[model samples]
Target: MKNEVITIDLGSNSFRVLKYDYLNFKIIDEYHQVTGLADGLIDSGIISFEALNRVVEALCIAKDKLNFNPNNAVCVTTAAMRKAKNSNEALEYIVKNSGAKFKIIDAEEEARLTLLAIKYALKREKIDTQNFTLLDIGGGSTELTISFEDKIYTKSFDFGIVTMTQKALKDGKLFEDLRNQEIVIKEFLATLDFSIKDFPFIATAGTPTTIASIKLGYSYFNYDKNVVNGTILDIEDLENSLKLLKEKSLEELVALVGKGRVEYLEIGTYIYKLFFNVLEKSKSIVLDDGLREGVAIDYALSLK
Candidate 1:
């Protein structure tokens, strides 16, 4: 019998659970729910009671629906938990209510896992990973990892779509704040010592995949991962899509981007666009595999 395991990613914007056959390295089933654990965290510096409840509820659903042993599960919480003041208490609440124990991983481990996933993805897709920079834009943090001339470099940024959107809203300068973020990104990239010469820029996570889905004419109900996985997204098309998405109401946007993500999509797109401009890349190869898949892959490698 194949050894099966469950991997859970408690993210800032969403909670994701995956059932995997680790021996074969295949995903059996998966569940995702946008609990927005970092909704007000940028200002508060704490995970709210409502956010804890939402996480507990989502975990409970995963437990009941997935029917996997908690002992055999690898659950990890990311940026939100790392920054939250009450992360311990929040974890206690989740375990007590849903019997799901989650480990809070630091930014370094997070980046390592993300890089591992992307590396696996590129290998599976038969893409050249000789020299590339992978960008993972999450809800509470953005991770940039570069594989240049056989050396791997990584850095995690504090700003993410949820946190950035909250900051912009609080400041009452949505577009202005986003524009300022672009400047900040450019300035930060200038400080990096690595010479990014002819590296193929790769993007993973929700923003790029969501934009790719829209470009492929996929809605929430009809999303095709194979089509979105290796899609090359052009900068010009990204900007045009952002403009069109800005006009969509929550109801209309939900059908395209999924629920709980409608509000963050615009700011996410803005940040996504900034990466292209700052990196001076005309297009990016988008991949759907990320931290959740990374954890599963890491676990499988551990058993070897």
Candidate 2:
């Protein structure tokens, strides 16, 4: 019999739930809803009651979709929830109202699960991962990991698409401040001393992979396993896309990408541009899987 596991990932911009058949090692069902958990966190340093209510509603919907009991589900919150001043309050509210218990994962754990997802995704594609740099860009944070000779070194940055756009890009300071930020990021990356020339870079999260899909001209945003496993984006093409998006207004951006993603797309593009500038010599590989899949993997391992 196949054992079923449910994993809920509460992110800054969206909430996602995955139901995996562990025996088959495959995702059987998935659900996503945008709750914008970070909407007021940047300005207020707390998740507002309105946002909390929205999340609670989403969680209820996710719970309704689950085939198993609430006790059998594994829930986790990342980035935004971790940094919010009212995170504990929010968590308590969810437990009280939604009957869902969630663990707030730290940066180190975030990195570890991300690597697991990367490794799993790579193995699924049968891609060689002897040398690669993995990037996971989230709404409230971005994680970078370097894998060399079976060892992985990871770092987490406070800079994320939501925070970056709210703090920097909307005010037109992103370009001016980008170089200084890049210098800092470059310095941190340099400490790892892993040669970029020897490895291909892998990117996960909504930003890069979505951009890669759009660049490839997918009519709908499906994570084609084929596209994610072996897809590569040219630096020039990515830069061009970012440049085009930068010229558009908020309404224009929304029209081009979709509602609930315009601001993120703007900030995500800026981050990618910085990533492109800093790692000029390396090529990029797209991965559609990340933290949610990582959580699912963790749950699968736990049952063993």
Per-residue lDDT for 70-109 in model 2, tens only? 5557888889988998899988987887777889999889
Clashing pairs in 1: none
- What does the lDDT come to for candidate 1? 0.86
Each prediction's Cα lDDT score?
A: 0.86, 0.78
Positional deviation of residue 262's Cα in model 1 after best superposition, in angstroms: 0.8
Which candidate has the top score in lDDT? 1
Candidate 1 lDDT over 136-167, as tens digits, reads: 99999998888877677777888888998898
Reference-based TM-score of each model: 0.94, 0.91
Off by over 4 Å in 2: 66-71, 169-171, 219-229, 243-256
